[model samples]
Target: MLLVDCSNCRRALELPPGAHSIRCAICHAVTRIADSRSLQPPPPQGFYSSTHQHQPYYPPPPPPFTAPSPYNHAPRGPPPAVHGRKRAVICGISYRNSRHELKGCINDAKCMKYLLVNKFNFPESAILMLNEEEADPYRHPIKSNIRMALYWLVQGCQPGDSLVFHYSGHGSQKRNYTGDEIDGYDETLCPLDFQTQGMIIDDEINETIVRPLPRGVKLHAIIDACHSGTVLDLPFLCRMDRTGRYVWEDHRPRSGVWKGTSGGEVISFSGCDDNQTSADTDALSRITSTGAMTYSFIQAIERGQATTYGAMLNAMRSTIRNTDDDLGGGGGIVTSLLTMLLTGGSGGGLRQEPQLTANEPFDVYAKPFSI
Candidate 1:
């Protein structure tokens, strides 16, 4: 077992046996890496008896990443094996009170699970999927728990421990006192209680959970919601919605707090904008392409078509244009998530994939992502 010098209590403590990660025994402040190898300390029962090292929370493992239903090759390898102690959480909530609404969310969770497992090879045990139905014995209902779990994962995260957080659900704008609905910066995962009681607000999500994460972790978050039709050019807007034609104008104010990536190193995939609706349908159930923005994001990452984050988004938006007739969703919102991601508040030129090679692992330099 590795040891960590709890920055909180300033005491050296041995980590729990087989513990992939743990919070400090004293202040509960998280540790990014195990203690320096030169010094090994006694177990947690030592001098800091009052300091209790709480087990960091981890959400449940996502649903098995099923092989593509129609693919001929058998996943190109064995069912993904767990790598180290990396973790992944998928929260899907599609079935709601009304059958017509069929608000399918967390579907991207399964797709994300497959992407991490098969493509990235995150360890099976470390990968966590938290659906509305799944119970995380180590976790609680608050999104804060998930966020803390993620923080711990990244804090103690090793080279191979990749963290992927995927949420597939509805996007909405909460009306502020100013009489304008603002895009919730801290997007939420639709829990089972979402219909009865809406999920956590983006504000609470960013403040409570996101603000405290470690600085450098390979964490990626994808929200298949539309954050702004203005940041990214809107594809096929429904003529019925009368949502005036999407102008390629940039709406992010230079001084607004919401303009930058506050989530830190975590790339966000918003479904639709503050004023738009991210549509859902059973149409792609028969097609290979995931019509949803999040799924398409995963597919782009998987096929290596979109290498860097920016390139990937460009490819996603292009897919919408190419398959506009195929997906049949006018507004072709496929690249909506990527738009907000790369723009970083400014709608810039197309981003080229970072130079890469077979000898070098895939690396993205998208100016450290944020929600």
Candidate 2:
């Protein structure tokens, strides 16, 4: 066995011979290490020269340099670990018997709940799951109940805790009244009783979930719905083209109510853009229906591959593309999920390019992806 360092997560581990790729136990980053011996530190300077027979001329030493100030700030520490107290709010709605009824939303919520508890180590008691099939009225996906759950997900969110919010259902776009939205439309998550209870607007979601989180807390939002981009009102947005190159934009408008980072780290994965609609399909297992975004998300993780933020987004996109292909060709869709994710919608010549956005600056690949 040989000790090797993980390039992405920086964890040192003993490598078994003939292993080409290994997942980091610390960050779960899968990387191909062809030669573990290459990770060894080089010998100290002058060791080779001193051992040589030939004499070499020594250059004059440069003047001594002053050390950096103690007050000078050092780089920030790694992100908060998910091993801390974890909480999640997962809402899945089929809008049963309604005109906008879906088939896979309820299943999406349950799948996410399972993944959180079994794979991510989230506590079952801490997870609040709301689905349309619930017999209890309070557990229904009503506007007020969803809002309360959103609030509950972030309540008591400490520095080390990992918070997740997932919504799989119909999404819509309404005219922006507050000029906070750049596209002249505010993205919304439709509740079962939206006709009477009203839709959960983007601004309120931000105020309820994103604004209150403290520094060192990590919020991972998986929104498998339409018009989900910027739903969390995070500050940054990353857009990637087919070439895998990406650009970041400041999404907050100049006079927006919520303008910048709230000292916490937020990453949102959306099913589609502000103008597009997400798909509820039955192709996940041929017989069982599920939200396309949710299916791809869970599939990407279940592959047990160590991947960066960018790589994970690409994997989800690839799965979505293949799923669309199996469903017969429609429009040319490019699906990618962002921290503030933007994905392409299928059919009707509409595109739902998934996107990833964040509150603070982060490396897409250098840092290992976590809950």
Go through the candidates in order and give each one's C-alpha lDDT: 0.41, 0.68
Candidate 1 local lDDT, 115-163, one digit each (tens): 6666666766676565544554333323433443433333334443346
Worst 10 residues of 1 by lDDT: 351-360
Query: Pick by TM-score: which candidate is best?
Result: 2
**TM values, all candidates:** 0.50, 0.69
Candidate 2 residue-wise lDDT at 40: 34
Highest lDDT model number:
2
lDDT (0-100) at residue 97 of candidate 2?
75
**Tens digit of lDDT per residue, candidate 2, span 1-371?**
44454566443444556777766433456667753323333345564456564755343443232332111111112222333479888999888777777777887788788888888988887787888677766678887567656645665567888899999988888898767778898888899899987898877777777777778888899999988988877778888757768767777776855644457788888987777777665334312466777866777777744277877777777766665434322322222223102233333322456668787657787768888
